[model samples]
Target: MRFLSRRLVMPNDLNFAGSLFGGRILEWIDEEAYIFASCQLGAKSLVTKHIGAISFETSAFQGDVVEFGLEVKRVGNSSLTITCVVRNKQTKQNICIADDIVFVYINPETRKPEPHGKTKAELDAEVLDI
Candidate 1:
């Protein structure tokens, strides 16, 4: 898994209980996953197809730094499956994990799934470029 981005938790990001909001973390995960998929597939036309079971193991409070890590699990004909983990940057404690998030490459004109024409080797090579 590559830790790609970090976010600083702020007061506005907190829930009434003063921990980071679940919806906000999910939003970050979705955005990070989309960016990762776009770079790996080298295409901008992609949509999130599915996200597997999510496990919220711990809480993050305001002023904490959290990191988002993602790893490609599988590359299919038109979809890429990835796993995500968000952890506390300071302690490396996992706060949330999603086992699988699927993104489908789509034809911009037709709005239908299209082959991304990328192999695992190709995707790994792109990671080196990043």
Candidate 2:
């Protein structure tokens, strides 16, 4: 798993009630997952093509530092499913925030999905049940 640590909650990240908004954290999930997956794929570049089901299990108020971990769950012919787990760094408790984001690397010139990385370690990683 690739860990994206300590995305500090900002005032703009909060709702009217002063709790961190779900959308902000959700966006971070997709972004971080894409970065992690792209690094794993050794892709020159990648873009999000799909966002799968998502669930938010806790609340993060202002000043909370959120940690999101990304892992490749499955790889298809041209698409990769990246799973992200969000956790609360302050409380040291798991929030279980999750999403399956799909990214396709593009050939800068052709703007198409192109295979890149082929390292044995990256190809062998499995999604942890956590």
Candidate 3:
């Protein structure tokens, strides 16, 4: 996975245990995956279809900086599956991993899934362009 974004763990993002909230991490993961899939497919009318197994290996405390990484795993006719990893920037310790976040392209007018016709090769080329 390529590094996509980073965030600092703030006091408000902590849970009762004084650790980063899992829900907040999930929100970041979803947002990063959405952005990656949208850029790869060149479509903004996308919906999250599913998020596969997620494992949290460690925790973050307030003031810790975390980096979110994402990579395109697969491209279906109408869906893109991406994987993500988040880790503490200073310690390089893994925080969480999400293997399959599937996003489907939708037609705004029809509000239905539509073929994107994109391949992994195309996605790689687009990344190189950036």
Candidate 4:
């Protein structure tokens, strides 16, 4: 997976126990995935269809920075599957990992799934060709 975004845990982002909120972390993961899917597919109309098993390995306290990493796992005719991992920047420890996030391309007017016409191999080639 490619490291995509970083965020600093803050007091306002904490739960009652003073740890980073799981909901906030989920927001970060979804946002990062959306950005990646939009960029990779060259389209802005994307919808999160599913998120698979998410396992939290550790927790972060206020002031700890976290990095979200994502990679394209598969590309269907109209859907893109991404895997994600988040880690503490200071300790370099994995905080959470999730697989099976699926985002689908949509047509704004039709409000229906549309083909993205991309594959992991194609993306890899594009990177290598660069």
Q: Which candidate number maximizes TM-score?
A: 3
Better of 1 and 2 by TM-score: 1
> lDDT tens digits, residues 80-121, model 2?
777888888868666655666888778889987776545334
lDDT of all predictions: 0.94, 0.74, 0.93, 0.90
Candidate 2 accuracy as TM-score: 0.82
Q: Per-residue CA lDDT of candidate 3, range 2-46, in tens?
A: 887899999999999999999999999999889888878878999
| Superposed model 4: Cα runs more than 4 Å off | none
Give lDDT tens digits, candidate 4, residues 32-120.
88998888888999999999999999999999999988888898999999999999998889998888999999999999998888888
TM-score ranking from best candidate downward: 3, 1, 4, 2
lDDT of 1: 0.94
The candidate maximizing lDDT is 1
Ranking by lDDT: 1, 3, 4, 2
How well does candidate 3 match the true structure, expressed as C-alpha RMSD?
1.0
Give the per-residue Cα lDDT of candidate 1 at 118. Answer: 94
Worst 10 residues of 4 by lDDT: 121-130
| lDDT (tens digit, per residue) of candidate 1 on 1-130 | 8898999999999999999999999999999999988988879999999999999999999999999999999999999999999999999999999878999999999999989999888888878887
User: In model 3, which runs have C-alpha deviations exceeding 4 angstroms?
Assistant: none
> Which runs of model 2 end up more than 4 angstroms from their true locations?
117-122, 125-130
